[model samples]
Target: MEGYLDIIIRCVSVYFFMLIALRIFGKQELSQLNTADVILILLISNSVQNAMVGTDSSLVGGLIAAFILFLINYIIKKWLMKSTFFGSLIEQKPEILIRNGRSDFKMLSKLGINSDELSEAMREHGVEHIKDVKLAMMEIDGNISIVTTDQNQFKETHYKRKHNHKNLQGEN
Candidate 1:
């Protein structure tokens, strides 16, 4: 019973520490990682492990840590709803990287995304080329949103071409 109680205390302590650390780190959306950001993230887990589980080095310590981590996460999420600053911290700002088929190379460099990677992301979203894109934004959650420049025009042109073809075929 004593060991169990000790484990619970250690877990709760670690949980609060992690919560505070995360809050202090500010809301860095996963997608906006620079080289330094990636390194800090990799180190964070190992650094916090000892605090989360007591020196006992047992599975029980690990389980308690996990439980505390979950509870803290839940609490933080609830708190975010009540605080606008927390919401903004947790959510990142959307960055416009492309507008009117032009790539904002400056923004791309700042975000550490190369032209090739951007091209690939665009391709995954069914954009064959940059010129076809009207707006491309890097969302706070690390997602890329691409809006085609002339969707309505493209659709209208396609229908016209198809109708003309059908008419020609009928005449033949």
Candidate 2:
């Protein structure tokens, strides 16, 4: 019984440690899992298994540890959903990359996103130029969203600007 209790404590400790580690590392890690990420996760699970089960190695002991982990995870999720402060601590806010044809260079630099990458995202949304974008946001989930005016609407605005400029030149 004492050994089982120790296993429970160790499992909980490991769980919290991992949660904090992931939080500090940033939510981007969870958004994309490349080969290295997969390898790291595999190694982490293998390394922590011993700490969780300890010397017990019994089926019941392993099951107990897993059950406790699941329960704690459920509770944490519930708490996060109910508390805005906790949610903000664990979750990232969306970032605006471009707005009304203007790019936020500071935000792009802070997020480690280069113009080429930003252009790629724009291209993915069928936008050929940054000037054509009305708004581009990097969502909290690490996906880029682009908003653009309709082609016909943009054309009308462009024509109106050209006509207005010609009239001003004629008056001058």
Candidate 3:
């Protein structure tokens, strides 16, 4: 019983540590994982496995740790959904990159997004020029959302592109 409690405590501590570390380091990578991100995640899991289960190599010990992690994760997610402050701490707010055909240069630079990246995103959304974009936002989940006007009908439409825009500076 004592051993199981120790395992649960260790697992919970490791889970929270990783959660805070990812939040500080940037959650953007989770939304769009590259090769390095994949490698890093694999390494992190391998490295933390021992910390979570300690020296207890028993299958039951490992299962207990895994169960605790899942429970804590579910609880945190539910709490985040209910608490606005906690949600903001763990998640990022969407940022406006372009508005009314004018690019938000300040926000673009702050987010470490280059013009080329933005252009590529626009192209993916069938927008040939920045001037054609009515609005462009870097969403919290690391996606670029582009709103454009249909030239023929003069109506607004939204398009999504998978991309990462780092950091944030309020809305435009």
Candidate 4:
């Protein structure tokens, strides 16, 4: 019983740590999973597994860890819904990438967005020029939402990543 209690504590601690880390680091990179991003996710999961379950490789240990994670997630969602202040702390506000057809160069640079990547997102939504964009925002979930004066608002989440592999097409 004591051992199980320890596992619970560890799982809960890790959950909160992850939430804070994501809040500080940003999450727009989540939807845009390139090869490297996929690899990083895999590695992180593996690394955290031990921290959650410790040396207990038993089935019950695994189930307990998973259950705690799910419970924490559910409770957090409910809490966030009831408290705007809590949600605001955990989630970042949407970042303005462009306004009035002028790109926010500082925000773009701060968010690690290059003009090419921004342009790619814009073109997908039928925006041919930055001057045509009424507003472009990087949403919390890592999707770029573009608004044009004449067109309906739309959002896309394609991450532009360059890879050098024989089987993959080269970057344009």
Clash tally, candidates in order? 0, 0, 0, 1
TM-score of decoy 1 = 0.61
Per-residue lDDT of model 2, residues 1-172, tens digit only: 8988998999999999898898776545654455667898999999999999899899999999999999989998999899999988877788899998999999988766677677766665667888888988877666667788645532211110111112211010
lDDT assessment of candidate 3: 0.77
Residues 24-98 of candidate 4 have per-residue lDDT tens digits of 878655554677868988998899999998888899999999999999999999998899999999888889999
Can you tell me which runs of candidate 1 are displaced by over 4 Å?
A: 1-47, 58-60, 152-172
lDDT (0-100) at residue 17 of candidate 3? 93
Candidate 1 per-residue lDDT over residues 131-151, each given as its tens digit: 988988876555566788755
For candidate 2, list the clashing residue pairs, or say none: none
Q: What is the lDDT of residue 91 in candidate 1?
A: 49
Question: Which segments of candidate 3 are over 4 A away from where they belong?
Answer: 151-172
Q: Estimate each model's TM-score.
A: 0.61, 0.78, 0.83, 0.84
Error of 2 at 73 (Å): 1.6
Q: Is candidate 1 or candidate 4 better by TM-score?
A: 4
Candidate number that wins on TM-score, 3 or 4: 4
Model 2, stretches more than 4 Å misplaced?
151-172
Candidate 3, residues 1-172: lDDT per residue as tens digits? 8889999999999988988897776535545665667888899999999998888989999989989999999999999999999998877788999997999999888777788778877766778888888989988776778888656643333433323433222221
Ranking by lDDT: 4, 3, 2, 1
What are the Cα lDDT values of the candidates? Answer: 0.63, 0.74, 0.77, 0.78
Please say which candidate is ahead in TM-score: 1 or 2.
2
| Candidate with more favorable, higher lDDT: 1 or 2 | 2
TM-score of 4: 0.84
